[model samples]
Target: MPDITHSIDIVIPSYRLEKDYILRIIRLSKPEKWVFKYYIVVDNPNVIVDEEIARLAASGDITLLINPVNLGASTSRNKGLEAGSGEWILFLDDDIKADERLLHNYVHAITKWPDEIGFIGLVKLPPPPTAFARALIINGSMMIFGIAEEAESFAWGATANTMVKREAVGAIRFSTDYPKSGGGEDVDFFLNVRDSNGGKDYKTLKEAVVYHPWWNEGRPSFKRSFRYGVGNSYLGQFLPKYTYYDFPNTPEALFLMLLAFPIVIFIAPVYLGSWGQLFIGFGLVEVIATLFQAAKRKAPLSAAVAYYVVRLKLAYETGLLWGNIARFRFAGIGARFEYKGRKHGNGFFQFNTYKIVKWVLYALFIYGVFL
Candidate 1:
């Protein structure tokens, strides 16, 4: 029971993804009392959409645009923005399953929240059999909805599911410089628009939501994890907020794992704490992390979740190292650990919650490097 006065225009960018997803999203997205226009931009050059989709566009059911070249999601989204003519523009990934009231919630949220700022909605992924993905969704990614703060200079709204006033975005567009997938394009575009008009910013809308099938098929492979790592590199190169979160922070980490792990294990018994104090201290971190996330989500704990989570962590870290190599090849990029005189991240805790230690260590390195 919320306001239903505003209309919605949706922009969905598709690469090599399936065509049915777009239709499914459109089907579930209709809301009561609000008009919605759909735009599906195909990024692939060779593959044409089925005749039905083209006919739908012709019949005014959807607006379809085909890219002559595969310019990536960010670019296609910009095109979608240009094609749209509504008061607000909604961005949705191809894989999402919209709630029956998803559009309704968004309209309600826009009425409730500040009109000048953009809004990032919630994304729910189906529970996966792998521990890594579950851990990722719960600990590392979009699951947490703490509190919202004003961030005009920098915003990190994910493009997967978000709403923004057309007037607020104005002429601002996504940056084309980052890797097509890995760069912080979502944040870049939102913050650019936010910062343009006298620092109007973005807020989180916890009620406007959708579900994704990210982990439903199976666990992601190491190659996929590596690509994510590579994308993380682009973020470090493009966004100051993720500087410490990227590969430039990894040399010492690699050094420690390769050289110090065995030494630490050997010395644990040799230096022999007369009490179990040392082991207790080491065990405390894992216990705390597990409890913190579980307490928030109230999710059931199990052995399987534990196993894949560990694997996923290592896979991404290794990708950071490899990502550095990839970055070097494309264009020489280096990590600037310290961002003291610069702004970073959307809000204070809009960073990796699981690796506070890595962030701290990287901060020290950045400071020491500058000195």
Candidate 2:
């Protein structure tokens, strides 16, 4: 049996919120005994706690750490970890609501594991959305974990809904160098842990269940897309093994059949029926691959089709953009682990002049190659 005496601390980094909602979730989803503390790191110190929070303030189980400025997620989380007093830390996004049994399940699951495990989290999904809410989910990523098993590998998406043993994270901190709050921080953290101890000891755990909050919003602008591209570009350098494993054929495979498909009726094509055939075949392959993944997840078929179209185009365009600007700089937010005296750098890159040039080249590349 695993040791049960060590304490667990749950850290929630929040911005502005309706205190009542936060209170409701905590009261309804009571945690287990191993949990020694609950810490909420807020951007504003003057923000009022909900009535219930004030009532429970004297219990000594909860602590609120106030920050003078919005230091972004990576920094704020590190601050929480510093103030926390437990052997294990549970990190939760502010917007999420726990399943009634989430905290208990986490305690049960984690206690069964060995000390070397680096991280763990519950299964999660985007909350059901109204038609209006669907808009917001467009560019947002959703995380869902399956049955409890030792993770064979590690990845960035795991951070949004997971737990990390205090010792595993004792030496690695979140990277602040990321241009934006939501960019490459997770990837940097995961890579650091994997590379630590000479890459011989890195582990992740997923045994509990949790839900991710989702809301419909607007489509991403070009600026947002480019920033995301730059973040991935930076991550590509660190975890060269896993960054772009999904795309094997790249520009070659996509460009070969582009113009030949739709122009078969009118324009004089050079390749006769070959390019047209490849275009249809590859397009079908793309659609099938995407739809299969979506179906397995029980996502709507129509939405799957739309997602395939949008994502394929975006991938092709972004690939060309990255190919052009092959440079990355570590200049943005950097996170420091106060207790551990460790830090990680999130890289930053400019998105102005190159952004326009990238789109135009991508458009031309698509037009000339695909038609």
Candidate 3:
């Protein structure tokens, strides 16, 4: 029986409104020193409402809003925001497994730092169950929320677990321009809040933890990555200052060029005879070098992992290229965009030895692939 000083609205947008999952979250959330309300927005209008969920809604334990038609996650979140009447709005994903202390920690942080506009909670991934999951973890695909956990303050955090002040989010809504599959809307929403408040005051609260399961059952999925890339194209349109031409710089761009090199040799054999073969040989050597390094590191599945990594990376970039083409931004077909507001650490050299070595290898690989 702690004194309640503030109110929080926990907003979750879900397409698959799982009753037991939502009930688990509600049961685990301990709003020790604050009053909180759950706002569940169902994005799929066709989803049948659960009897228990409807009963909870009727009992006022939660506010359930079923969309009249299918809407994207962003629009669903906007609907939740419109319905809530709390001082803080905590955005969460329906799939996440909430920690028992999730709401309690947030309430403590909010009380301790009343002036802060937002706080990002830590979203952790369970141990990788498969080789592909391990690869994704190592390659940084599964570490999006983990990265924010290491930071004291960050530019944007995934809506999977984040709390924002209602005043700071006044009139700011998640962008509906992204693809229906969802991608850049979370980033766009936070960036908009940051811009409106004119500060990077969102602090990271590592104590509030949530677990997000890997998609596709810990297996590799190109479609999900490709959709993310397509969604990223909208970021460039919304925030052009961070976007730049990616040609001749990124490994993805270099890989595309390498794939097109044979056409160049075939078209102009006289101009590029043996040189083309030599160039391709160098690329082969780069691949061999990578494998050798992996062997030295004692990673048995390095070859398979590397193959999947390159394949997924290419898929993402291709989707980005197609997205740019769809938007008629021909010049930005090979564009590089950095929507993540701030970077942790001082410079590349300041990174730990492992990171430095990884970056050096990447640079060498890029150079070799470009030739």
- Top TM-score hit: 3
Cα RMSDs, all models? 8.5, 10.5, 4.8
Instruction: Name the top lDDT candidate.
Output: 3
- Against the correct fold, how does model 1 do in TM-score? 0.68
lDDT by residue for model 2 (169-285), tens: 766887776644455566677557655644533334454556555432323334444455555455555544442222223233455344335675456556556555555555445
Clashing pairs in 3: none
The regions of model 3 sitting more than 4 angstroms off are 1-4, 248-301, 342-371
Off by over 4 Å in 1: 1-7, 16-19, 28-35, 142-154, 197-201, 241-252, 255-304, 329-371
Put down candidate 1 lDDT per residue, 1-371, tens digits, no spaces. 66666677899988744757777776764656677888888898887677777778899988888899888878899899989888899999877777778777777776666454677777766655566566665545433222222222225466788788888888788878757755446656765676666565466766667777764466655565555655555555665543432332333244334454566557764443322333333334444444444545665556666544545555655565666665454331334322222354532333445456545544554454334
**What clash count does candidate 1 reach?**
1
| lDDT per model vs. reference | 0.62, 0.53, 0.75
Task: TM-score each candidate.
Answer: 0.68, 0.61, 0.82
lDDT of 3: 0.75
Model 1 sits at a Cα RMSD from the real structure of 8.5
Model with the higher lDDT, candidate 2 or 3: 3
- Who is ahead in lDDT, 1 or 2? 1
